[model samples]
Target: MYVLIVGAGQVGKMIASNLEDSHDVAVVDRDSETAEDLTYEYDVLSVEGDGTELETLREAGLEKADLVVASTDSDETNIVVCGTAKTASDAFTIARVRRRTLLNTWEGTQGAFGVDFMVCTDLLVAQTIFRISGFPRAQDVETFAGGLVRMAEFEIGPQSPLVGERVEDVDEYDSMTFAGVFRGDEMIVARGDTVFCADDRIVVIGSPTSVKEFAMANVPETTSSAEDVVVVGGSEIGYQAAREFEAHGFEPRLIERDHDRARELAEALPKTFVMESDATDTEFLDREHIDEADIVIAALESDEKNLLVSLLARRVGVDRTVAIIENTEYTDLFETVGVDVAINPREETAEEIVRFTRTNQTEKIAMLEHDRAEVIEVELGPDSALTGRRIADSAADLPDCVVIGAISRRGDLVTPRGTTVLEAGDHVVLFVDAAVLDEVSTVL
Candidate 1:
């Protein structure tokens, strides 16, 4: 496969890095230095030009490009780039846009602007954060097979009930599977004797109810519902979170520093209490009783401001805080400084793009333990390798690091035992070591 990506920003560069290892990749950016840096870092071909221009795209060899991703910061430029690429080549085109209006218009019109797919960064990040809100300690959560199967990852806290319990003694839920365990640099395929330690990141796949049961059994307090929630900033992310919370029957209180934006948000979200106050000021938070909330969400546009507000919320005695981080490099630092989780929009966007690049029957992909392992959901067809076969026999012949976590059939969730048989039309969710992803793909 050959891929040509426009914009050498973090999202574009990350996509190029992921694709260059297995497919031919070329990146075009107006910034010569950024394009050059990607060329050296990822060993991908780089073209310095305006991708929105027909002549510039032609110079980048778009006619032979199998896929073109328009990821420039400007939505207009990205739309034009995709339209031009479609006009010049038969390649699939994807546009990365932050504006919700463009997404709605393009999606409803069915490639009216020539984009095969559109990704809204803010909306995706907002939706992701909403799904994992108060989901115990899950740093990341993804659902597959019509919400019947769930994949969750989290850092083991010192107070967790299962801290010293072996996997066998953890009282396995009927529908849950312990997928993978990570301790620093090692990735361990979770087994009966495997012991969970403090700070060890664990990934699990199971039915939603079973996953919730596991969380309640292990990390009870953080998973508590019906708590006060306070969200900072009136940006797109903040407003989206407010709306999502409202849909979930939560009348969250939102604090916006800008008076005009606060009024607009108040009108937009009828259930949420929109307040006009300086989120950075400790006095404002104390006066408003913001620290009394169970969770504080920092969605300010600036990474620095988000970090500051999260710190202030913690200082004021908020137990858990989730912050939107624009800078990917500040993730670990933010966590170390007491922020519960830092959401990286660019990284999330890149993961979505890379997942869409897969050529097999894979429907969804979730990166676990910082990409050391991955959980992929694939549909079994009549001709596929595992269809109508017992898992015990098939799993024995499969790669060592691969494990079948669950199977979804006609909306029913099944935690596959050795005797379980995989049938056609079943969606099989498998956890595989990142090193063996390609090998597993070939067999599937």
Candidate 2:
């Protein structure tokens, strides 16, 4: 497929990087240096011009493009780019925005801005934070097969009970599969003899019940529920996160230094406690007993402030700390320095936008460990390579890095095993190394 990406920013560059390996990609940016940099960085056509202009779109070969993505930092510019692209071509248009209001408006009126699909960065980050908050020690979480199958990534803390247990011995959960493990920079495919270690990010996929049971077992001391949640900052992402918790029946507390913004948030969020105070103030933190909270989320606009808040929360005895990181490079550093999880809004937005580039056979996608691997849900067609073969036999013909995580047949969860046979119409979720993603897609 030929893809034309507008705005060559972080999200656009990521989307280009993910697709340039499989499709024909062209990027349009107003900055000559950025366009030149992208041209030399990846095997893509880089056009220097305004994306919303018709002449620029023509120069970028939009006439023959299969997809057009508008991913500028400005929400209005992205919307206009998509709308403008629609006037000249029939390519599938995707716009990335930071405002929930724009997404709601586009949803209420489908294709309102000539955008075939829209992704809200703040909203996606908020939802991701909310999902991670549900399971203790989970670095990332995603659901597949209509919530029947779940995939979770948990970091083994220094004191975790499964520190030295072998994968085979930890197979107590009948329906769960040990998909893979991320140890430092190495991606180890899980096996019977694979032993758990401290700080290892283990990815598991299975029935929801099994996943939940595994989470509870992994952290026996931490309660399964996140009751007392605290959000620092009044940014859109922070406010949306507090709203998400409130919608789920948790009256979270939000701290914003700006009195006007705090009042606005308090008015908008009925169940959330919005306090006007500096989150760094130790006296205020102690007076409110913030140390007793189950989780403290640092969503301030500044990366340094979020890091400071996360470290302070940890110092104050909060069970977990989730920080919003604006810089992609700071993700690993923040986690290494003590933040439980560091989420990049642009990364989340890029992942969501790239999901649309998958083949029609793919139903959903979840990128893990910063695109090192991917867990994808695919429906087997009548002509699929594995439709009539047992998984054990099919394994010989498939890539070594791929693992059949779970299967949903007739709305029932089916745990994958070597003896299990795959049939047409089965929704199979598989964990695959990103390096072989294209090859795996071709076969299944």
Candidate 3:
């Protein structure tokens, strides 16, 4: 596929980097330095010019491109670039917009402007934080179809009553199903006899009500309330997180290196305690009693700094440590270094745009990962041939590229075994590698 990306900022660079390995990619930026940097670092063609200009876009071969992504920091620039691309070419266009206030209006107005999709960064980040804060016990929550269904991840603790319980013996709670269990490094397809234990990360899928019931039933009763949250860094994202935490009845403390920014944050959030000091400094963190924090979030702009501070918080016995990482390349490394959660605002925003772009098609993607993998939840079409077939009978016909994790039918979620049957109207969640998306689509 030929793809043209308008912007050389962090978000544009990430999208280019992710797609460059498999697609013909070109990046456009008004700043020559940024364009040169992208060209030097990746295998993408870089064009230095105004992407919204028809002449510049034509020179970049936008007419022949399969996809055009407008990711500049300015929402106006992105909108204009995408509109121009859609007018000049038959390409799929995606535009990135930062303000949440513009999102509802844009969704209704973009079609007239020739925009294929609109991505709102502020809303995406806010939604991610909101979902995570709502379910403090889950390490991650990926919603599908406007929150109609969700996939939540939780780590089993030693005190969890569900530990060591077989799948079959566990009572179904609010129509939820265990999707898959990540035992150490391997992701296992859950079975009836599979037993959950401490340290195992389990993925469960269901409606919001059922998921909450499942968490209430399986998680330890000793789970602490979200009373104290320490946010390290006073960047925009950090400030937003602090505001959100405060809104949710949490006493938040915002730590920053710059004295001016710290004072400003303190003034803006009178309920939150603000400390002026380097977040990476152990002495400062210790003085602030970091160990007493229920959740410690390292929201520094730099990924390395965030990772280091999060690791230190972990070593000092913080209950949960989350790091805000700008660069998606460092995501795996942050996870390896024991960061409980790594949030990438740019990547998250891009994902929302991609999901919005695909809403018109039958490819109902639920969650997208930065690593080129997608988890899709699609209802079995009534005319589909696989309906009413048993899992054992349909094994050979099912696409080898897709893995069915769970099935929901008649308000009951079932962890399908070999004998489990698939009925029409059943919503099946499948984790698919990007390489075989077409094959999976054909099979479905």
Candidate 4:
């Protein structure tokens, strides 16, 4: 597959990096250095020009490409790029925009913007935060098979009871699989001989009940219903999050400093309590009894401000805190310094664009171990390599790192065992370590 990506910024570069090895990737950017950097470092072609222009797309071989992804920082520019590409090629069109208003503009209009799918940055981040909020102890949570199954990542606490136990000795349930463990920078596909240790970040795949049970056994968490949520900042991200919470039937209080903006937001969002008070003011928070809140979200404009408020919230007594992080470098600091989750909009946008460009056959794709591995959901086609084979026989030829998490056939979820035989039209979820993506691709 030939993938032509517009804009070589952080999000564009990440998508190119993921697709470069498996497909033909070409990047377009106005900056010569940034475009040249991708070509020099990765197996991709680079065109140093504006992607919204006609000649620029031609220079990047847009007409011959299988997919065109527009992920520039500007939403208008991205829309124009995708529309332009649609005129010149028959490629699948995906546009990354920061504003939902821009996306709604083209809805029900055929080829109006030439964007087949639109990935809204704020909405994706909000949805991710909302999902993780349900399992406060997990660092990351993604659902597959219609929310009946889930894959969650957790960092084993120092005082966890399972710290010294071997994988083989632990009681196994019919509903769960210990998928992989990240010991420092190394990834280990959990086997019988594997031993649980403190500080080992592990990925688990199971039903929601099983995952919650497993998380409870491995991590220390406060026993809170987390019904009350406090949101800081009147930024666009904050507004979007509040809207998402309301859609999910959760009423969260939003704090804004500016009086006029607060008043406008209060009128606009009747479901949320929009307060006109400084979040930095400890007095206002204490008076509002914010420390007793179930969850706190710091969505300020600046990274420093978000960190400052999150730290303050934690100091006061919020058990779970999520910070909106723009700079990727601040991600590790936020986690180490005690923020429960740091939402990076660029990464969220990049992951989806890469996954879509990689394949059109798979039902869904999710990155794990910081993109070192992928969990793919696909329906077994009639010609699929694994359609007629038994699970054990298919496992023998596949990479050792592969783990079949779940199989859905006839609306029933089956935890795959050795003798399980996959038939055509079966929906299967599997975790494939990055080392064998090509092999996994061919099998499915």
Candidate 5:
């Protein structure tokens, strides 16, 4: 597939980077220097001109492109680029929008603006922070299909009451089901006989209310308490994260280099403590007592700055360190550097765009990356051929591209063995290489 990307900014660059390995990508920006730099670095085709102009888009070979993504910082520019692409090439167009009001009623604007999908970075970031904040004990919360279903991650600490329980006997609230558990580097799709041990990272999936009830019932109360968190950076994303933490009863201390921005954020978020300080300075971190904080989030726009701050926080023995890394190229490096969580705004935005674009085929619940593969969720239709077939029989009929992760039928989530049968109303989750998505879709 060929894709044309507008803006060449962090979000556009990220989309291009993620797609370039398998798709022919072209990037356009008004700034010639930025376009040249990205092209030189990523080997992507660069078109230096205003993306809003029809001529500039034409020069970028939009006619042959399968998709056009407008990811410029300006919302107006994004809308214009999408409109022009739709008119010129009739290609699938996705526009990046930040305003909350626009996203609240995006369905009304979809056809009028000639946009196939609206990627709301603000809402995506806000929703992500909000979900994680709701369950402070969970490492992450990923919801699918408007919160009808959810996947939550919780680490088994020493104090967790579920440390030595069998899977079937484990006590949980009525509506929740344990989907899987990750020990060290292996992921075990838990069966009835599997046992839970200390320090196991478990993934649970169920209805939103049921999952929350289950967590509260099974986990200790102290585990979910948000006492204190230190956030390094005053970027928009940082402010959003801090706001979320504050909303969840966490005391947030924000550190930023710019005094004026710090003061502005302080005024905007009265509950949060805003301090003007360099995040990478270890002495300053020590003086601020960052080691005492329960969580440290490095949301600096620069990947290098976020990484440095995260490393310092980790060295100080902060329990959890999350860094917002704009560059997708450094994702692996950040993991190797010991950052607890690396938040890539661009990749997150791209994932949202892709999800919106492909909403018809599959409901993307969460994206998990392994050694060299990705796992995604797709709901099965009652009419689907794979339904009602046993795992062994379905495995032979399924295209070589997809591997069934688990099947959620009725309210029970089962890790399918050879004899386990899939039902007509089941929701099947799959782990597959992203390259074969098309082939996998046909089988479903």
Candidate 6:
């Protein structure tokens, strides 16, 4: 497959990096230095030109491109780049926009802007925050198989009950599967004898109820569903997050500094408590009793501000803190410095867009731990190697890094086990090491 990505920003670079190893990839950016850097950083062709121009698109070989991703920072530029690419090539075009309004408009009018698919960055971040809010102690959360199956990564605190328990001993949930564990930089495939350790980010996939049960078992107090939510920002992402919580039956509090924006949010979100004050104001936070909240979400536009807000919330005695991080490099730093979870909009946007680039029958995808691993749902075809064999038999032929997490057969959740027989048309969700993703994906 030949993929052309227009933009050398973080999102574009991430997509390019993921695809260059498996497909022919090219990148177009207006900055000469960015284009030159991309050329040296990855095994991709780089064109230094304005992606919105047809001549520039031609220079990037858009004529023979199988897929085109417009990921420039400007939503207008991305839309125009996709529209221009569509005018000349038969490639499927994806536009990355930060505005949810554009996504709504594109959804109502399918392919309105010549974009085969549109990824809204702020909305994705908001949704991620909402998902993480449900599992209070989880570092990451994702739902697959039409929301029946869920994947959660939880970091084992030093005080966690499961700290010294083996996977077999803690395998109490009927539907949950211990997929993998990330200890420092190493990826350990979960086994019955694998012992839980402090600071280990363990990935679990199973029915939502079972996943919740597992969470509650380990950290009952911290893993319960978050009810008292506080959002510290009136940015689009923050507003959407507050609205998401409200839609789900939670009356979340939102703190906005601007009076007009706070009033606008109050009117837009009837159930949300929109307050006009600085989120970093210690006195205001104390007055509002923000320390009593179940979770505090920092969605400020600036990464530095979000970090400050998250740290402040923690200092004020908030149970958990979820912050929106614009820079991918700051994710680990934010979490290391005490933020419970750092949501990166660009990474989420890139992950969403990369799923469409798959050549096989992949239904959904969730990248974990900064692309070190992935949990993907794929439908088995008649020709698939694992279609007619038991999972135990099929897994033996695959790499040890791959773990079949869950399966969905005709709208029913199927907990994967060694004896479980795989069948055609079944949607199988598997946790795979990034190193073997292409290999495992090809066979499945």
Best by lDDT: 2
Clash pairs, model 4 backbone = none
Please write out the lDDT profile of model 2 over residues 1-444, one tens digit for every residue.
999999888999999999999999999999999999997899999999999998999999999999999999999999999899999999999999999999999999977999999999999999999988887778899989998998999887778888999999888888999999999999988988999998889999998778889988885465777899999999999999999999889999999999899999999999998999999998899999999999999999999999999998888889999999989999989988999899999999999989889999999999999899999999999999999899999998779999899999999999999999999999999999999999998899
- Writing each residue's lDDT as its tens digit, candidate 4 over 1-444 gives 889999888898889878888999999999988877887888899889999998999998987988999989998898899889888888989999888787677675766688888889988988887888777677788888888788888887888777989877874767888888888788888887899899888888888887887776668873424588888988888888888888989899999999888988898788999999989889988999999887898988999999999999998888889999999888889989999888888998998777776455687778875588888888888898888889988887778999898887877888888799989988888888987988788878
Residue-by-residue lDDT tens digits, candidate 5, 30-89: 997998898778868999999989899889998898889999888888888998888878
Alpha carbon deviation, residue 187, candidate 3 (Å):
4.7
Candidate 6's residue-wise lDDT over 22-106, tens digit each? 9899899999999999878999999999999999999888989999999989999999999999899999999999888999999
Residue 197 lDDT in model 6? 86
lDDT, residue 398, candidate 4: 77
- Considering lDDT, where higher is better, how would the candidates rank from best to worst? 2, 6, 1, 4, 3, 5
Q: How far is candidate 4 from the true structure (C-alpha RMSD, Å)?
A: 1.6
Clashes of 5: 0
Better candidate number, 1 or 5, judged by lDDT: 1
Structural similarity to truth (TM-score) of each candidate: 0.96, 0.98, 0.74, 0.96, 0.70, 0.98
Q: What does candidate 3's lDDT look like per residue over 1-444, in tens digits?
A: 788989888888767766676678888999988888887899999999999999889888897898888999898888889888877798988888866555677677747456777777755665566576556677678875445667778877898877989877884754566666777756555667889888787777767777777776677642434567888888777877887777767778888889888889989997899998887677877787988777787878788888888988988878777888877778778877788778888878665544433323343554434534567777787666567888778768765444566676776666666688888888777766666665665666
Question: By TM-score, is 2 or 5 better?
Answer: 2
| 95: Cα error in model 6, Å | 0.4
Q: What tens digits encode model 1's per-residue C-alpha lDDT throughout 1-444?
A: 889899999889878877786788889999888877876799788899999888888877788888899987888998999999987799989999998888899878987799999999888888887777747567788989878888988777888887888998985699999888888789999888889998788888998888878877786466554268888999998988888889888999999988799999999999999999888888888888877887889999899999999999999988788999987889889988889888998888888888877756899988765567889999988887788789988886579898899999988888899899899999999999988777787778
The clash tally of candidate 4 reads 0
- Against the true structure, candidate 2 has what lDDT? 0.93
Looking at model 3, residue 40 earns an lDDT score of 82
| TM-score of candidate 3 on Cα atoms, chains taken together | 0.74
